[model samples]
Target: MTQPSRRSSQADPAPSPAKLARVRTVAQDAMRGARWWTLLDLERILRADTEFWRDLWAPSLAIAAHKVGLRNARSRLDEAIDAGFHQTDLFEPELSAAFGADPDWQRVIERARANVPVPALRLTAWPEPGPAAPLRLDRAEAHRVPQLLPRLPRPGEGAWETAKTLLGWTAGLWRHANARINAGDALDVLEQVANGARYSCVEYSIVLAQGLNALRVPARRVWLRRGDYHDGIGQGHAVAEAWIDDLDQWVLLDGQHGAYWADEHGKPLSLPELQARGHPARPVHVGARELMKDPALWAAYFAHASVSGIAWEPKGFVPVFQDGQVLATERLVRDSADAYPRLSDLAIGVTAIGGAPAVELKPVHPYAVAGSWNGETITVQGRQRFARVLDREPGEHRAALAAVTPYGPLASRELRWTAS
Candidate 1:
């Protein structure tokens, strides 16, 4: 993908908020969170071409809702039709049947999901994950990934193939990069490791997701933060999860462990459900331990799920944002295990880093950054000093970043910076 022509080196001076406000029109557009059909994005589409919106927009939403099994979706479509808002030519038959023609709603939804391209434009990264992550699966990779598919079983028969594939992904063709995460495009990092270079767990999670998406399988990276308490494992880790639309849920598939969570029925478990499980202390596979470079030799991590921090549908390595908060559709984030308070200073923004204004983390995450957030998202990790340009205005603005750390809630120091 072409990097936006707008360029900024690590050494460039942090543009003042005044200058940034002038460019907000551009930066904010690029920073939009996933494929969310926000007002601004809608305006862009409407301005780009109305017929595009008129023909594709409502129909796409209907298709998307049906795909995700969103409740009352077909009803909404029928409502649209009743109001003459939706053209009949644009109405999908399966969708129409789901509401009226077909008596079996479940069957209708399944059929719609099976036949349609995943309708991601209206979905968010969480609650219902979308397809537009920055780390992309382009046409080339999508076509190239099928060769790797058979190595893991198709996600059936209790996901045996899913287990093998997850293990294979974590164990195969990847070297752990000892450096900081590149922090932007998942594809860019995968390119580095395509010929067998090193990447972090975050990168591995993304690559696995990309491969699945290339095959037209829906998936997203799962952020697994080691809560304040642990078996002495690392602070955070990432893994990939696949969307079983038929099941209407996401299930964990950890490449690093060649493992996944399952219910008593031995079915795959979604991140939220897994977090809510009564997981006890468990053992981490030796290979998994090696991959993570954890200190506890017997693999204390596997014994039980870390409950303190489970930001289901969290943002990607290159974070996404809308409004002034992180990109999660669910505002209330809690891991059933840890009852400690959550932190509000959990975000970082494109502020000055060490007296230099830079979006990409230099000498750390080594990739050009794209995407914007007002202030709602995880701050750049790694032990770096960074700040965010405040809301463009003429007065003082209070900034807050919230995150859940192992020790408890993490709060950024109360910062009141004047915006003038």
Candidate 2:
């Protein structure tokens, strides 16, 4: 037998300075028994705090630099364990915490070592299923569009009529073929709408979904990762899914791409095939750089293009009202500078008003006067506005004020009305 060539050994590659720093920080944190390693803890930390990232930034940059040279980040991480610079437990602290106290980790490692060969790939050989059953649109649903349009004068100016008018307008927009056409050509047409400041990717997706739902077309917001469409490395995409009843299957439509359910040959493609062609088996991490750039693109991707249904920021921050009372107010502050000016002023007013025990106020707006009661003091944004209680008696007290904004009345009923 030929003698084996002498193997040349080089010193193990040194970790990048950044990588070493990260490892040191993580190691230090782990030593301290901090809960920061847990996913739930991480999420909580991200939501309630922002400064944590500042602390981790240096380490993250270092880790990223080390990972840059590695063919596969995961593999490189594993190699670090083999080289004795790092332990597997360092990477998966959650698992270590779960099983380190017992022999579970060893048992798991042993079980994994005896792994059998994976089964061979098998094609789905079944024939296409029959077409789906016909779905009937109800009168209420069918007439939903017609009702949405501005109607002629009606008998009563009832709230139901107003709601019906609004619904009718919405329905008309959905039922209109042009609206459908606009959605069909969303890739091109939507940009114009965005330019007009009338629509966004999220709004467009919602409009499409709502339109379909109004027409009795079952549509859902599907989330998935698009591997190819990336502004930068490892940034995936998202989209929507609609259930086509006549086709007896779910259809993938790219509201952003303006592509219908058909392929190049105009043949309808199944959900699986569509996903295989566009979406990937694994999701790429959506980095801050991608989000900070054109958030609308990502928003559109998540709202209309995703296959996993885990889209980000689906709802616009609209306040919630329950039984003529404001339950909660939500506002989406895009830029801090824009938000601070308005919010700071409101905060000051609230502080000043709430500082007082009680005071009387006169009507400033017509809507305000209608709702004013004898003694009502309204608390808004931490500020208090008092209204006189006009009909205050031993057994009864009522305060009224005009409607404030669209949510509810302005004044509170508890304050004594001091008429001038």
**Residue range with the least summed lDDT across 10 consecutive positions in model 2:** 341-350
Tens digits of lDDT, candidate 1, 1-420: 222232111222445566544444442353243232332223323223333333444444455445545555455344334333434444546445445555675554454344443322221111111222122212225445555554333543322343345446555656566554566444555556665667666666765665555434445665554433223336456677664433434556665554565566666666656545455223233233334333343123332232212332222221232223243332223333121221121223344445543332121111112112334443453443333333445555554332322212222333344434
Which of the numbered candidates is closest to the native, going by highest lDDT?
Answer: 1
| Number of the top TM-score candidate | 1
In terms of lDDT, model 1 sits at 0.41
TM-scores for all predictions: 0.33, 0.23
TM-score of 1: 0.33
Clashing residue pairs in all predictions, respectively, total 24, 43
lDDT scores in order: 0.41, 0.32
Error of 1 at 354 (Å): 67
What digit string (tens of lDDT, one per residue) describes model 2 on residues 1-420? 122132112222455567555645654564355422322222212222223322332223223323332222222223333333222323355434433455454754344334432323221121121222222211123444454222222312432222223223322222112233234322233334435434333333444443444443444444333333323342332234454433434554433333333455555543445433543222211211111234334433332222222212233322222223322212333221221111001101112333432223433221232233333324332334532212322332233333232223432323222221
